[model samples]
Target chain A: AQSVTQPDIHITVSEGASLELRCNYSYGATPYLFWYVQSPGQGLQLLLKYFSGDTLVQGIKGFEAEFKRSQSSFNLRKPSVHWSDAAEYFCAGVRGTSYGKLTFGQGTILTVHP
Target chain B: DAGITQSPRHKVTETGTPVTLRCHQTENHRYMYWYRQDPGHGLRLIHYSYGVKDTDKGEVSDGYSVSRSKTEDFLLTLESATSSQTSVYFCAISESGQNSGYTFGSGTRLTVV
Candidate 1:
């Protein structure tokens, strides 16, 4: 079973500040990783995904994540934070033989302040 | 954005009553999944279907059942609704297993009292 861990339960960042949400996964082989964002009462929106190729992957809303095999981490980062970025972020992964089932982390709630 | 819709955006059902949640998709994705999101549990899969009649259980499949009669419709049934089943249920569609990621539905808030 592949499991994901999001070290931070809550993160607060000031407007225009750089942001990074950590994500760690435990799997036997390389896993397909994804980032999702959700507002208070809405469904999840895909941010980005990484399987192979370039280590750095860019996503919408000026978000990006780097896949580091050595550390088994795929962390989401943003150069500048916006007040509208306040939402809950989730890190998920899927193993090859697991079909389409996704394993998600506990999630990290982001709060942006001005 | 993948044309996925979960019926009864919000519902409150009494305990011991049977409730069914529907997930209809226009995207025609091959894979459909049912997940429940709790306060600290994130999203836990209940069941998933790979094809019209092929389905499999997920991690938390103890008290839930799912069926896919058509390619676009996946139904999740709570044989007998319980308070423990009260949570935000999400339906997600994936064209393929891993490469395409997934597009999620708006979700259905089910409350059992």
Candidate 2:
């Protein structure tokens, strides 16, 4: 069974500090990876996706993610975090042979402190 | 957001009552999906439709059912709601299944008392 794991349940970072949210997956083959952010009282928005391209992918709001095949990981990163960046992040993916079905991680609640 | 919409943004109903949530899309996507978002579960697929009248169960389809009678509408129904079924439900659409990513709606928050 394909699964996504976000090890950090919650992360607190100082505003203007660098941030990294870890994400790992388990699949027999290469999968389509994505990062989504959900702000309070808002729908989930696509941050970035890794299908078949450069390992380093850029997304909205100055966010980026690196897909590491050997490590089965697609981690989200930001060089300088903003207070508005406080929100829940989810990592999702589907097996190479699968359809539009997505396996999502447990999500990480990010809190930014000024 | 613009293409997809969910009705009854929030609702409270008694346990054992039947509740239906509506997902409407104008993007004419070929694939539609229903998922439940819980505190610790992130999002779990309840069901999905490939085309009109073509549906399939997902990982968590025990207490839920779905129907897609038209290209623009996908409805998710809870036959008999339960307290444990209280969750925020999201609807997503994809222009191409498996090959493309999905667009999600604002979500419907359902509370079963």
Candidate 3:
């Protein structure tokens, strides 16, 4: 069975500051990883996904993540965050055998201050 | 956007009653999924469909049943609504391969009293 862990439950950062959200997964094979963002009372939106390729993958809203196989981590980062970037972020992975089933992490709530 | 829409954006039902949530898509995607979002448990998949009339149980499908008679619509039914089932349900669609990411609907917030 595959699982995802997000170490931070909540993080607060000031506007224009760098932000990083940690995500770690346990999978036997090379995993298909994804990051999703959700605002309050809204459905999740895909931020980025990593199947196989460059370690650093860029996503919408100026967000990016690095897939580190050695550490089993795919951390989301933004050089400078805006207040509108405050939201809940989730990490998910798909089982290689399963067609489209995804296991998601607990989620990390980001609060951006001006 | 994948042109997915979930009906009854908000619903309040009583325990023991049956509730069905409808998900409609215009993108003609082959894969559709149902997921419930709770406070501490991000999102848990309840069911998914690969094609017309082809559906499978997800990680949390015990109290939920899904049907997909058409390629553009997937319905999720709660046999007996319970307080524990009160949460935001999201419908998502993906293109038919591992390379594509999913597009989610706004979500349906169901509250069971």
Interface RMSD of every candidate? Answer: 0.6, 1.0, 1.3
Q: Which lDDT tens digits does candidate 3 get at residues A4-58?
A: 9999999999999999999999999878999999988878888999999899999
Q: Which regions in candidate 3 have their CA more than 4 angstroms from the true location? A: none
Backbone clash total, candidate 3: 0
Candidate 2 TM-score, C-alpha based: 0.98
* Top DockQ model: 1
* Candidate 2 per-residue lDDT over residues A1-114, each given as its tens digit: 899999999999999999999999999888899999999878999999999879999999999999999999999999999999999999999876666899999999999999
Worst 10 residues of 1 chain B by lDDT: B1-10
Per-candidate count of clashing residue pairs (backbone under 3 Å) = 0, 0, 0
In angstroms, give how far residue B7 of model 1 lies from its true place.
0.4
Q: Please write out the lDDT profile of model 1 over residues B1-113, one tens digit for every residue.
A: 55999999999999999999999999888999999999888999999999999999998998789999999999999999999999999999999988887999999999999
lDDT of each: 0.95, 0.94, 0.92
TM-scores for every predicted model = 0.98, 0.98, 0.97
Better of 2 and 3 by TM-score: 2
Task: Encode model 3's per-residue lDDT on B1-113: one tens digit a residue.
Answer: 44999999999999999999999999989999999999889899999999999999988999999999999999999999999999999999988745677889999999999
* Model with the higher DockQ, candidate 2 or 3: 2
Query: Which residue pairs collide in model 2, if any?
Result: none
